[model samples]
Target: MGEKSEANSVAPSARGSLHEHHHHHITPLKEKKFRWRVTDEHSPPEIYNWTLYLSVFVFGILGSARGYDEGNISGTVAQTSFIKEFGLKSASLTATQQANLKSNITSMVQLGSIGGCILAMYTVDRFGRIRTLQGVCVLWIIAAIIQCTSHSVGQLYAGRLIEGFAIGQTTTIGPTYLSEVAPKAIRGLCGCIFAGAVYFGIMLAYFANYGTALHVVGRNQWVIPTTIKCVLAFLILVGSTIVCVESPRWYMKIGNPEMAAKNLSKIRNLPVDHPYILSEIADINEQVNLEKHETEGTTIISMIKEIVMTKSIRYPFFAIAFMAQVLGQWSGANAITIYSPQLMSLVGITGVKSLEMTAVLGVVKFVSAYLAAFFLIDFLGRRRSLYIGISIQLITILYFAIFLTVVPQAAEKGAVLTHSQDMAGKAALAALFLSGTGWTMGFNSIQYLLGSELFPLRIRSFAQSLVMVIHFANQYGNSKALPKMLLAMNNFGAFYFFVGVMAISLCWVYFFIPEVSGRSLESIEEIFSLPWYVIGRRGAELCPDHSEVNRVSYNVEGTGNAHGGDIDYETKPTAEFVENASNEGLMKSDSQSLEK
Candidate 1:
């Protein structure tokens, strides 16, 4: 605890430029320069160079495996050829039966993903981050082969389940590797890249299917997209071997500090003895040491017991895991992402137009998620971003829900709709587009961000695995529920249920999430240590002052904020950094902390 405290505290610095020009060269201090606002801000530009990026991309690209399905599955199953090849169009099958079959095909991957996530819980640590992803990549290729060559429905389900297993492992490993390998300050940037790849895969798949639907005919329509999955998996598998490096922290975790330093120096383009390398290793060791001390023997049951037994860890874990299902999955975003083509069909838009709109939805989801991490979350702060995003979702989805409830199409379709009905239907499509934007900015970003932000080191693996499992389970449940719900009530029932939950989610967000933007890895423990009721509104204010003081917390005044929030710290430094600093007390008004 003493060491963790020292890691987050920064002394005022009035002398120096943040390091620039790299490799064993600690260039002589410049003639004159302004002080560093915070410690991690002292990072060298060398850390941002080519080697770091290549390594991040090698693992980050794995997100595409999960995302490709989100975009392509709807379009793939919608194809004329796929429909006939699987007897989906047969007069013998009822509409409900056809919907059931399509739901199974779309959701089998999600079901498989749940199992894979469970497996990843074991592999991620045992096999290590890089090797786990390598194994999953190979598994994905096998899954893709089955997916592309399937002649029977049973075969397709088998392939998708296998594919889901691999994708689950990839997502689990990708972010873990990105966080561990990238320089601490730029870890946020790498996370955005991972997310962008997911959406990019979705967007590319959407457009590809839209193109194939128009340009190609016959069984080749679905075959091309399935084959594309294999190509993507192959690329990731090859990139890992050629480009990625083992995480330095992983070496430390396994009790090889010397090897950890070796890898850290290579990653940072610094000598093993460089001050930066030593400090980073110390921080990793502190956390790793803490993790081992607390968990002792790491196991799922033990990890769960660790959280349940500790109030500080328990509150945050339960808070986030609940949100993963409520705000993340059941809030209707995944349903919309997975079943969008069908939703478009519901609004009197079918065939080519439905596929095209699905393509557009992909564009909206990809752009908003990618940009929000960099812009929205930083500019708006975590809590407000969720508020504004949910507001957008509330308005758009409510309008769309009302449209469905009041429409003639809600009852039974007439041959031709009145002009007013047609215009209202167009508005409904726009509502979906806007709703998707709202979801990405609000729920999607926050959910992923909190998974990384809120937990202590010891409980991180179990908490993440649990969160991910719920996420996929919700996705699978929603996929099955939508078709059944629409069959039971009107289509609007699901959205009404979603809107009601979202409205509740808004209140929940206000009373739960704190301003997590600029808090360091160590200080997060202080914030979550508070009682649950106050953690949301006052946690940041009440916790130890570790934020980079230069950042503005909100727009309350035009002048610079007294408490600025920088990006969250990727690692916590050791006592050596704090003791060595010139304590002008920058953290006090010289930078004084706000202590409760």
Candidate 2:
């Protein structure tokens, strides 16, 4: 404890010395060029190598596990074979009973996810991200086998419930791993791969379900999709075991500085003692040291007090992540995703055609997610990207609300549509696709991206675990009640509710959430020192933009080779850049969005 506390005090001078040495050694190499460079050249080009990209990509694939579960269940429940095999096709069942049965089947997974999330709170910190996910893969495999061979409704429910454990854990662990491993330069791009995979996973499940329904028969129909889910889980397990390295930040938190340096070096593809590796480890230690001084003890109650009462330390990080989940879940994206078939049918596209349309909607969502990750989140900045996505959602949802009001098709029972109404229904169908795009680009990415990035490393696992608990809770509640909410609120009222929530989300975001696209994780801690109410509006202005810092570019070797007279550059470590940012105009991070 004393050592970590003392470590922070030495970083500035140590970094300053290292910066001057590197500047004198390599600054003259202006005419030299490397094979590749991080687009902004904020980081050593080595950090952007194939090893880092592939590692993050493989870890990112875990998002598909959650996506598959969400997508598969929606279509799986609609399977004729599944319905008949599970006795859900009974003619004697009343409408309410049928709704209750389907809700039970769908929501049991969420109930189990709540348990898995609680477990992740401990295991992610205890076992590390890679191992926790490996354990998750094993649990999911067990669940998948149980689901595949189930002969009765009770067994099916049990299998689904058990599978939720893996889903719950994956949701917490996936983004955390991505954020830790990603270089700050492409953190938004890399972190977003996890979000993008959700869309891909959904698309895969929808396509799988569609293919099975059209081509397969008997118990095999549901079993085949279940098998696909199992295979994906297995693939993730193999990737974790064979490809990815342990999160170096997790190692630093656990007091394994040697291992932390080694792993960070591995991920960055630099030498174990590279200056960047040493500096990063120091930066991470500074964050840990800072967090330690803020709290009184390691007890649960003490932790709670720090998060809730401190108001300046953990509170903003905690609250930002927490509210992002709450607002995101209520934005009605998941509900729309799970009920795409029913909603599509409401617009007069029925039978297997509804399933087909839902799958296409999944494609729209997947494409939008990629667009946000690859281009918007880092380029437009987090706040601006969200605004763009919300604008799209607002327009689409309002169109839906107005169309439902005018048509009154879903609000009434056995109402035959007039010619104009039928044409308008088609347009509503198109609007639903548009809504999928907006939701993916905005709420879905925010929930995963911000939830992972907002917290300090010390509380990240617990924070994310708590967030996922809320996440699955919302998912469970919506999955169970939305079937009923659709009936009780009337279809249009439900969308109207989402419309109100979205408007509030926009305003709340503007007033309470800061633009955080280009800030370092360690630097983020300083932002909360401001009054909470203004943090969102003022936070972006507080941190430095490292990528914009004028630095001599390094060559294929970690630092540039000795050359002619030094090119114009400053000698300061990224950490010192953070302090400079507070007093000067700016200091550090790896994106241009901060320049805005």
Candidate 3:
């Protein structure tokens, strides 16, 4: 895949002119001017404009809408009035019945999300990213309205399932859209924003729940949160339609390269002929062409077969994509997010205290996700971030196991916790806080980032849908079974299960995941095309030789002459170079001239 080819070398004078003229536009200072203004030491800056940032911001809020739905129900279900109003607290209900009802209320969202993921798989590619998002935003609003006005349990369940479907779509598409449009230099950070938005939504839901619980005296406690989510959904609906631009890749995939180029130019605030803009388009075309060549028939079954059966593509690409979600879901992150109040009560912190603490957990998660998006992801790089964060999560879950073992009574939900039990409860809360932080820093965000980058454009939406289906399946199963697990094995046993799962996850990541911090989307394809065994420990070092393929050079003199000039050039290769150099020996004569 990294093999070089031959092409004609331009004359020295013409080549020098091309190099010098293009040089001014690709400089470090010029690149920094285009980069998103964020304080991070590790990530090199690249070109970005307000159009791209605005689109990303809107998508971030879309993610927050998903988070709001997930987090709001946690607090809503905890309300005394909500429980009584819905017969969840009725004396006729057995312990088993109550647990089932609580599970249904939360797990239904996962069911809805699964449906949404399937819907997005078809629509995102057919209707384009922005259009699909707009359609789902309307669905979300309808679901919210149904929830706000529900008079019975059946109606509430119906509303929640609908809401989940929309969220599921948004969660998958938002990151997909952002990944397709973001600059390579800050792609990880941009993807992290979607994850951070989820935490942000969770935080807002917690605060709303806490405030409503204290101030509102009736069923309105739950109703207000539902209504707020509805308003948010409406805003997203309007904004997505009016503000967001269509993904350029979607246009290119549909064979509308002209429109794709136009949108790309608009997003980058550059002319269609600008080297960066041209390079991005060429890169997309190169990847698309590769996919076309590999899967000639291009049917659903064939794509799956190509991804699963082909060794060169499967192990490092599809398998890694699938496991990224597995690690995230199996890490017990969603178990904690959906059941924080119940989890807290098991550790002897019940009543309003539990609600307050859940809100604080939300704050911690939001802050951690925010920090990871702006500072940690680009700084630590994706591979190291996943390792360190998962390790922290493992340690925190281990703490939970130990705390529950030492204070067995604390594992009994609704028990009147003693002073020591209270101390143990605080410890458990701290551990939960740490776990949430760890998840946001790595697994929570990196899963989406990797998913967006791993699959070829031909199968990206479908592949993401497949992964999301697995993700939501894990979430649904976990949400429904967690309450029962706590009852059967005690809180200690549950944490012990998660601890073991995370430990294995740590090893899997260390052995399989590769570093893709600053690489371009097209270049990522070449990295995966390498031998699978070589991808583990030194994957970043072994990536397809990008030196000449995408390398761009600049001259300080701003003149066409290469002699007696102070030159500043980027080793980063362009898409045209990558494609042209594939002709065998294209680099033979110009290799020295191309060198800085």
Which candidate achieves the best TM-score against the true structure? 3
Give the per-residue lDDT of model 3 (tens digit) for 404-427. Answer: 888887756656767876877788
lDDT of each: 0.71, 0.74, 0.74
Q: Per-residue alpha-carbon lDDT of model 2 for 90-162, expressed as tens digits?
A: 8889867788898899888889999998899889999999889999999999999999989998998999999
TM per candidate:
0.84, 0.86, 0.87
Write one digit per residue (lDDT tens) for candidate 1, span 565-585.
222221223221222211211
Between candidates 1 and 2, the TM-score winner? 2
Residue 53's lDDT within candidate 3 is 84
Q: Scored by Cα lDDT, where does model 2 land?
A: 0.74
